[model samples]
Target: MKKTFLAFVVIVILLSCKQKTGIVFPAQWQNDTLQQTAKAKANIVNNLAIDNTYQFDSTAIVSGCGMVALQKISKDYRYELIIELILDSIPKYKQFSIVDFRDHIKITLNQYSKDNKLINDICTDTPVYSKDQKEPITFTAIEGLMTITNIDGKHSPFKISLTTNNLVFQNADKETFLLPKEEFKDVLVGWYAG
Candidate 1:
């Protein structure tokens, strides 16, 4: 009886120790699911306001490498506003003060000809214009800030919030153009480079 009880106990222990097969998930499927979840969570909010006046709820925003471009054109195509930013490196999640990162940041506004054949005028950082134009229209970021909220991957989705004070630029023809304070909040931009 003792031997039989011991044998029964051993069998019970072996049964309890037996490993059960679990539902196995493929590695690729797991990775894909994780990526999908991340992409879903990183929602893109495209909102831009200039001087608290001209508001653009949805604008075409694109980015590549260390550059970002935000463009808006009128329905009639008579007016166009393009704000481009060139950074020294890939933007990460951080806030950059225009005053300190002035050298590393380059912003530009381009004006095309009536037929869109040539770039008739441009307002940009002093350095960019200095190379091409004898007297380039230039503007400075007196008071501004740039905040990068997310950078998923090298060629993935990202978000940025940009704000600047009044910007003044003088054209080659000695015309003064004033760009009022601008703000871009939670703008959804994508990186297109590998």
Candidate 2:
């Protein structure tokens, strides 16, 4: 399962290497399902939003690693994006896989204006988190960050920050940054909304 997840991430990264401003949806995602890759990615994260204890995960916890996507979801069309990952299953659900029983992260674009929301709570007809597995995966986190090591034997660093313009890679604190716009525009994290 870990190997498969790694392969998927590699494939997603390779496929996303297109021209600047390119917004490639996951190859598995049909255009009918999600018109906008970023928008769909954000909307698809609803399932893994909570744990059995009914506690919601935070954007900081899920940032870094796996398939990451930043979408716009406000009334007005605002150019924006940020990096965030899924959490709660810090150890078991370390990779990007639908069958992992954990979905991705939902980021609230507090850094941007109110015009275009990041579609954090946007709804979808299909289920994002996979239930094909019987036993539920569990994980632990400290200060909203995953405390367990990933399958790659490392933890993802929270390096990106959301702005009114594009996804920026910053230091640990996200207080400083640079433009990953050209690179990010072509990054496709794939989709698992079914």
Clash count per candidate: 0, 5
Off by over 4 Å in 1: 1-66, 86-100, 112-155
The models' CA-based lDDT, in order, is 0.45, 0.33
Write candidate 1's Cα lDDT for 70-127 as tens digits. Answer: 5444333223445566533535456656556655555544343333322222222232
lDDT of 1: 0.45
Alpha carbon lDDT at 32, candidate 2: 47
- How high a TM-score does candidate 2 get? 0.17
Best by lDDT: 1
Alpha carbon lDDT of residue 83, candidate 2? 38
Query: Model 2: per-residue lDDT, tens digit, 1-194?
Result: 99999999987776676444465656636764556755545422232222112111122222122344444322442322333455444244232322233245433332333333232322244435433322212122211222222233233322233222222222234332222122122222324433
Worst window of 10 by summed lDDT in candidate 2: 136-145
